[model samples]
Target: MEQDNRTAYFYLFGDNEDFGMKSCWIRNLTKAPEEIEVKLMEKGIPPMLTKEFCKFPEGQESLNKKNLEIVWMEEGDGAALLENGEILCVIPSWGGDRGFCGYARDCNGQGGFAWELSEDNEIRKRINNAISFIKEWNEEVNPFQSLQPQILDYYEDIFGESEKYYAIDNSDWPPKGLYVYEGTEKIVFATVAVSLRPQPKVEMYYEDASKVNRIELGIILKSGLTNDEINNIASLISGITAIPWDYITFVAEGHTVEFETIASEKFKYAVLTNKLKLLPEMNVPAFGNSHTNFLWIVPVSDKEWKMMKESGSKVILDKLDTIGEEIFSLERQEVV
Candidate 1:
């Protein structure tokens, strides 16, 4: 097999002010020559560790006393440096506490792998190297794949422009909207449709003058339904239950629409009667006036609604509560 001859550079900085060993360079010469040796040079001290330097063991009391500034070794690359006129030495082999480590540094005579010098040029070089590594890793591991333009085109037709909308990763719900890099910039299309279905406020009222066991369930739909459609829906619901048509009222899109006449022939008709034939499996009814062309009303049991209200858990309810409070304050001239 052919040997890999790629080389990487690591920039090191020193602490000595008088000697000014502030900047130094380490060139990985693993594949260059077998006799290539590692050298550490200081102004006063003699050259230390002049032999073929490959790796060194941990806890070398001699080198520890010298207090090296930077050390990096990985695979076929290795180098070490020191400042303060200290003579640093090392053996040739790849094993120790710092074995196979890529980058290691010291600050104020402290030995560790963390790089803390933000103002130094060496630290900047290391940051650039890290950014390059991240970019390369992203390219190899999480490559940007362009979404099918046709799918985006369809959404663009319905929702207007593609750029105006944001992509959401619905794999996790409540459907997290992806960041620009993770979605739009990366060519990942937004797959979820946005629509307005204002939360329904539940109110209970007496069904009859007698005020017995029967109670009328009034749901105020703040938006997304026409008066006629609400009347038809109310009539249909009345037919299913023993509750009279007069008991049902739908506050559709800010206007109150009540189903008053149960016996009258004029109020018995359903515009979406044929449409309602496809029940249970296909309950979502689309109104032409809807901005999104569809209205989704998820039916929840009274027990579930009560539980959700008690816990303050439903996100839609929370949003609606905030909006209602703001609107109420504005209506009363409390907030200008």
Candidate 2:
């Protein structure tokens, strides 16, 4: 994908300036000993200018030993041909504030997405996986509909023997309670113990040398998010993990429902990773509802965490305590 000239400059210098000629000057310096005279003629640079700029600084012998090729790119269009005629790989610059990552195709006219490119191939693959998770989320899983008592009971009947039934879908599963499957996508009625499983992780690299990735799916009951939209999300994200559909549960508290699962504590950290813009603060019913916003945890190694930071997911270093645990307390009240 083409990127902006600013993206390229930012990649190289981590900043932008008109005199940003580091990459180019480095290139000319390397060609000095053998091709300096000839190259200066081609660029119309006086031989004296080439000699002065290409001269090795003290303890910088590596400049003479190296070969560098610099290229120019159109603003916002990352495509460029290096002096050696090689096209650099384009990687997206992730903006965490936007909750997504992709390339910046507009630079001021230098052709590169960034200066140092490493593992972007892997990062791109992971970002694609993240998008897939979002798409799948839109397809399956009724965030609200999964909460009815009837639905929870349905799964309970299948697995609640000492509730020895961990496998709710077993053919021998018996319906010991009310079996209700309301057609409304947002509001379901069932007496089963439903569970919400975490979604798969997406790993993508960004220009910051940091990595970007996400786990599970978060559905903010944004305005206009209908019952159908929530259900579609559930269905799409359902089978991405081994956590069975029967284990996923959504609990209703009023006009909205929150999702969770028996395995939630393990992956609850995902909530901290994604920003959740709750509905506009209401003055009447202060706490919003009588329950906590849902959460899920995802186990990742320190290496994975570091890689995640590299992709632009800001490290919550000083605030690990603030994550996983919810601070809200809603007191149940009857709706008139």
Q: Which candidate ranks first by lDDT, i.e. highest?
A: 2
- Tens-digit lDDT string for candidate 1 (1-336): 001122222332223232112122122223322432234223422221112332321112222324344332111122344334221211111212242222222221211211222234343443343234335425633211212243345444533463423333224212212111112211211222221111111112323311122121222222334445434444443332221211222222111122333322232211111111112121111111222222112232233344445653353233333443222111111110
Candidate 1 Cα RMSD after full superposition onto the native fold (Å): 25.2
Q: 1-336 in candidate 2: lDDT tens per residue?
A: 112211112123323332122222212212333223556448844331122232221112222112333232211111222223223333232211132212221211221212222344454444443334334435555332333343344333532322211222233222112222222221121222222222111112223211111112222221233445434334323322223223221211111112232222222112232232221221111011122222222223334344445653333322332432221111111111
Q: For each predicted model, how many residue pairs clash, with residues at least 3 apart or on different chains?
A: 1, 79
- The ten-residue window of minimal lDDT in model 1 covers 269-278
Worst 10 residues of 2 by lDDT: 327-336
User: What Cα-based lDDT does every candidate model obtain?
Assistant: 0.25, 0.26
Stretches of candidate 2 above 4 Å error? 1-88, 93-113, 119-331, 334-336
Which candidate number would show the highest TM-score if scored against the true structure? 2
TM-scores of the candidates are 0.17, 0.20
Q: With candidate 2 superimposed using the best TM-score fit, by how many Å does residue 128's alpha carbon deviate from the native?
A: 8.2
Candidate 1, position 204, lDDT: 22
Q: Any idea what lDDT model 1 has?
A: 0.25
